[model samples]
Target: MKLHGVDYTSAPSRRKGITIASGELHGDVLILESLTSLPDHAAFDAWLRQPGPWLGAFDFPFSLPRELVEHLQWPTEWAPLMRHVTSLTRPEMRETFKAFCDARPVGGKFAHRATDFPAGSSPSMKWVNPPVAYMLHAGVPQLLAAGVTIYQLHPGDPDRIAFEGYPGMVARDITRASYKNDLRSKQTPARREARERIVGMLEAGQHRWDVKLDAGDFREALVDDGSGDLLDAALCAVLAAWAWQRREARYGMPEFDALEGWIVGA
Candidate 1:
């Protein structure tokens, strides 16, 4: 199947934004074909509507914490909750989430999903640091509008399956070296070395998914950028390819809650 891994940003720009790693899975490898950077959410939404049979692993949360939702007394159903979330502004969301956290204990300020532990993902309601809350606000509605099937979440067009992916899970598993960063100062030679090692591991099938990277200049491409967005996108692509190979096995994703979706290959 045609596979894509998207490294998303809530607010994209010409300097830094969404990068999609596109490729096709061969017998036991994913051929890294090309990388495309989209500058804004509108462009991403348009890309989602392009006619094709492709499965993508998007680097964004598909759902919020069920605990948080229940605490807020918001719509418990997936579709309705998404609608409610999309309707709110970011400041409004921040205030709502802040109030929720303020009422909770210090050690448990943020609610987590069942998949968060294994995936090492941030709380979906977090508005800063990674700002995934904004990503969900920007991305999920577009997926719904494009009629892409979201695995165990709301189903639409099956051929265009959109799975949640965490590149850190794979990167952490592959090496101890820091591979990519958003800050230019942190993108050091050591990190580049780590990226090389990670690429080598993936090529050697060290990930144990029975997949390898097709022979190419992928190593250079993965480490060329300091922000690590490109490498992360590539990792997500590999995860997407792995999931496609094991599509019958539910892509190694656990049976997740309908209101809190699971991350594929986490």
Candidate 2:
């Protein structure tokens, strides 16, 4: 089976498109085959419609925290919950999430999914500092419309499986130093060096999955892209390949609430 990894953006543009890495798993190595950029949601939708005996690991939250959902009294079921969420406008989502946060204590403001701590991901309800809530609003609806299977959460085409992946988790395993920045001025040699270190670790199969990365000529490109979009997509590919290796074991996922999806290899 082919494996795919997506570095998604809520608002895609020429500069910050949804970046995808497609590859095949060969023994313990993931050979990245190609990188595709979807500059708009239309492009992403078209990509999703492609025929698949493929599994994708997307860098976005698949569901909201059950605690937040229960507090909001939204639909408990996955499809119904997503349907309710998609019906609202972005402003509506922001205000609602803001109200939720406003009612809680300072440090404990944001509600978190069970997977967040293990995955080292931001709260799906957060509207800024990555704005994952907006990402969920923008991305999940498209996934639902495309009719792809969302692993344990929803059933669609079994050949097209989707798993939530956190590239930060993989990067943290290799180094705690900041390795990426979007601003040209902040893209220093230090960050580039960190990216080089990450690439070396991946090629050497030094991370938790013990899966090597064969990026070939793309290695320099991954390190050179100071925004880290390409590298994040590549990391997601490695995680997807790891999941493919453990397909019979539920894609290396633990039994968690279906209402709150998991981050693969968390």
Candidate 3:
């Protein structure tokens, strides 16, 4: 946690490739009516897998939600299962998960995404959330291969050597609640305003980035996605936005330090 680098979900494309982080969106991407501004899922993951000094992101969890891990009884716990998921083919993974869901209730079935923070994530195996089931499907396997630490499906104990992040907790601090975290309909205008306020805070340099055991003053941004796919990614953008600042400042912008505290101010 030495404030090495930041993470971003290649999303909400502001242009073909420009101002990627100037607190400004491109004219074409800002039309407010065109979906062109939104980056595709493929593009998003591609950006995430890019090499270099990033911390982590909201694209999808480095780990799956605890709820799903337990329900599937996939044993993604210690060494074997963790190693298991890492090597299984996507088809094998699909068939196995499909069987489990096939036996669950109709209203509540698929797995939930780890980014469904504060919203009180489902049992993960609960399908009412849909795609996240697939997220749990597509995401977890990758973490295994990368050798990233994914304890209890949340980076609990950690790999001890690796450094990855979920990035959504930073956003949840805005209102200290869940609804605002949902990408679904519950994300109200008030929630949007709260996130904007925190973003404003960063722009004005209003908090300490120090990771001391006792350093206070933390501030961050939050955004509710209509589709949870980009929820974590968007949150990562916000994290990266702040990171862009901290990095530009050489980690001396009062928002970074030793081996603790969240990148956003915690």
RMSD to the true structure for each prediction, in A, is 1.4, 0.7, 10.9
- What Cα-based lDDT does every candidate model obtain? 0.87, 0.93, 0.37
Clashes of 2: 0
Q: For model 3, what is the C-alpha lDDT against the true structure?
A: 0.37
Model 1 bad stretches (over 4 Å): 208-210
Candidate 3 local lDDT, 147-263, one digit each (tens)? 443322334223221223333454444335333433445667765666555444433334332111110122222233322222333333444334434444632224321211122
lDDT tens readout by residue for model 1, 179-259:
877788888999888888888888888874557876376668776788888888888998899898888888877777888
1-266 per-residue lDDT for model 2 (tens digits)? 98999999999999899999999999999998998888999999999988989999999999999999999999999889999998999999999999999999989999999999988999999889999988999999888889999999999999898899999999999999999998999999999999999999999999998889999878889999999999999999999999999998988899999999899998
| Best first by TM-score, ranked | 2, 1, 3
| Candidate closer to the true structure by TM-score (higher is better), 2 or 3 | 2
**Best candidate according to lDDT:** 2
Query: Quick one: ranking by lDDT, best first?
Result: 2, 1, 3
Poorly placed runs, candidate 2 (over 4 Å): none
